[model samples]
Target: MSENNRYTLITGGTEGIGLELSRLFAKDKHNLIIVARNKERLEKVKKEVEKEFNIVARILSIDLSVNNSCEEIYRFVEKNNFVVDNLINNAGIGSFGSFHELDMEKEEKLIEINIRSLTKLTNYFLKKMIDEKTGGILNVASTAAFLAGPKMNIYYASKAYVLSLTEAIHEEVKDYGIRVSCLCPGAVQTAFQNKAGIMKNDKTKGLMMSPKEVARIAYRDFKKGKVIIIPGFKNKLLVLGNKLASRSLGRKIVMHSNKSK
Candidate 1:
């Protein structure tokens, strides 16, 4: 793809850090393809981005949690003859409470969206990027990826997979000039907490950060080709502490936080 036509495709781009990242890229003059399940919200975001940045903004509405969703998205792009220069896998869902107590259907959907679908989409885009030999991928993970999250077990595990997968792919594709970065952010003040049932806890509230702050740090690190972008100094310290802390102690800390929720 020529520099003039380069496009960045961001999943879950209607709100939160995904939306903020879209704004940043739009300001940089990259044509955008923003995906979200809500057509109304997507269209609103599309108009706002177009008006503010004076760039083309495309909205793709699809529930990424559904099986074969990634394939469908790939088909849509191919049918439209769209070429992506950047792929941002930012769509994910979280479930709180004991694993057995959570709704089985919801848990399955979380896995489908947070893990399976993200992986599939990354693979699909990475292949295209490798063929072009010039593109980037950003996978949004979480600080929860570093340790076992007792109440949010599946979500944490899914993020761990994202972090690990991105690192592995970064190593594999560096020679090809393809950049892959995993953004591991701590608590961000987004609808995510409310959706995940995390907003009820005081502990989580204490750790909360604004979505824009996280996006700024993440975007900087991503452009610098950092493989792991952990936003905020405190979050960085926590990740480092977790790595050095004893497994039993770390598990205890994680479980203790869950007890309040």
Candidate 2:
């Protein structure tokens, strides 16, 4: 497929970092395909982006956590002649409190959306990218990926998988000129806290960077072909500190903070 005909497909592209990232791609004049679970959000973003950037914006509304949704998305784009040359797997969920106390069903849904769906989409688009011998992927992970969090265990582990998978694929496909980047931003001002039922912690708020800032950094670094892109200086330091401390110590600190909230 030719470059001009391909699309930069971003999951969860209607809000937060995902929405900001969509804007960046649109501003750069890439034809876009953005996904969201809500049809209203999907249509709004499509029109909003298309108007501002004068780029083609196709919106898909589907719950990615649903079984076979990723395959459905792959098929939809295939039928539209839209090759996903730039895939951004940004849809994810998180939870707070003790793992045992957290709702099992919700946690399971989080895993399906955060890990399973992302993996399926990546694998689906990867085959096409490999065949074309071009294209890139940016998987939105989190700074939590570098540490084991006691409260948000599933969320952290899922992001770790995303980071690990992207790194491995970055190495595996560099020879084919297929770039894969993992974005690991720290706390951001987004609906994620509300959706995750995480209390509005002042510390988290203080550390938060704007979603637009994170998106700008992610897009820039991804283009430079960085395997892991952490957005801010403070976040970079936190991840660095995690590396310096003993794993148990770092985890205990995270657990205590969660319990305090």
- What's the TM for model 2? 0.96
Question: lDDT tens digits, residues 38-69, model 1?
Answer: 99999999888888888888888999888778
Please write out the lDDT profile of model 2 over residues 1-261, one tens digit for every residue: 123667999999999999999999999888898888989988898888888988888888889888888888988998878788999999998898777788898888999999999999999999999999999999999999998988888888999999999899999999999999999999899999888988565666866899999999999999999999999999999999999999999999989877776
What local lDDT does model 1 show for residue 47? 89
Mark the 10 consecutive residues where model 1 has the least summed lDDT: 1-10
Clashes of 1: 0
| Per-model TM values vs. the true structure | 0.96, 0.96
lDDT of each: 0.88, 0.90
